[model samples]
Target: MTVRPASVDDLPAIADIYAHYVATSVATFELDVPDRDEWQRRHAAIAAARLPFVVTERDGAVAGYAYCAPWKARPAYRATVEDSVYVAPSAVGTGCGAELLPALLDMSRAVGVRQVIAVIADSGDEASVRLHRRFGFRDAGRLERVGYKHDRWIDTVLMQWSA
Candidate 1:
């Protein structure tokens, strides 16, 4: 597999992966799956800001994607970024996420980001939690019942690593 910067052409595939998560799982809190146009707009905004957005390709097909967005709006919060990763369900557990995350981290650090944060869905996603922990992100805190999805309330586990 190869990891590389996401381009405009990759947005559709990225949207597909994200829409799957939004529609079928509690992994992401998005209640409504967004359309490709909006996804492109959002991606364009991030790209314009030179944020890190990466895709993992396996045999020329996008298997997963990872990106880091500003955690907050203020300039004072500039050094921190929130990380996101979405692997095509078929690609999960095959090291697609494993490869994508390190590249995202490296890119974030390259751009002078000092801290990276990940907001995990819930305790049920043990593998994802372990993945972040493996990359030196510690369990910072958990906001109980912070999100509602899939007919139940869920927690958001905050994990962070200082780069």
Candidate 2:
């Protein structure tokens, strides 16, 4: 597998991966999948901020993607960012996330990010939490019943990693 900065061409695959999670799981609170135009706009915003947006390729196909966006719009939060990672269903156990996350973090550090936060939905799947922990993230806190999705109430687990 190879990890590299993502390009416009990778958005469709990235959208697909995210769509799967949005449709089948509570990993994301998004009820409707964003369209191509939205993805393009998001990519542009991240790029404009000089943030990291990357993809992992296995056999020349996008296996997973990760990116960091400003945690908040206020200037006080400029050095802090929130991360998101998603892997293709077929690549879940293939180490795509393992590769994508570290690359994202490294790039974030290189670009002067001081703190990275992951707001993971408590979807009963501990894989995301475990993965973040494995990469040195610490439990920050949890917000109970903050999100309503899929006909159920869900919580969010906050994890933090500081440079």
What are the Cα lDDT values of the candidates? 0.90, 0.95
Off by over 4 Å in 2: none
Candidate 1 ranges beyond 4 A from true positions:
none
Backbone clash count for every predicted candidate, in the order shown: 0, 0
lDDT of 1 by residue, 132-159 (tens): 9988899999999999988899998999
lDDT of 2: 0.95
Q: Summing lDDT over every window of 10 consecutive residues in candidate 2, give the lowest-scoring window.
A: 91-100
Taking every candidate in turn, the Cα RMSD to the unseen true structure, in Å, is 0.9, 0.6
**Pairs with steric clashes in candidate 2:** none
TM-score of each: 0.97, 0.99
Residue 13 miss distance in model 1 (angstroms): 1.0
For model 1, state the Cα shift of residue 130 in Å. Answer: 0.7
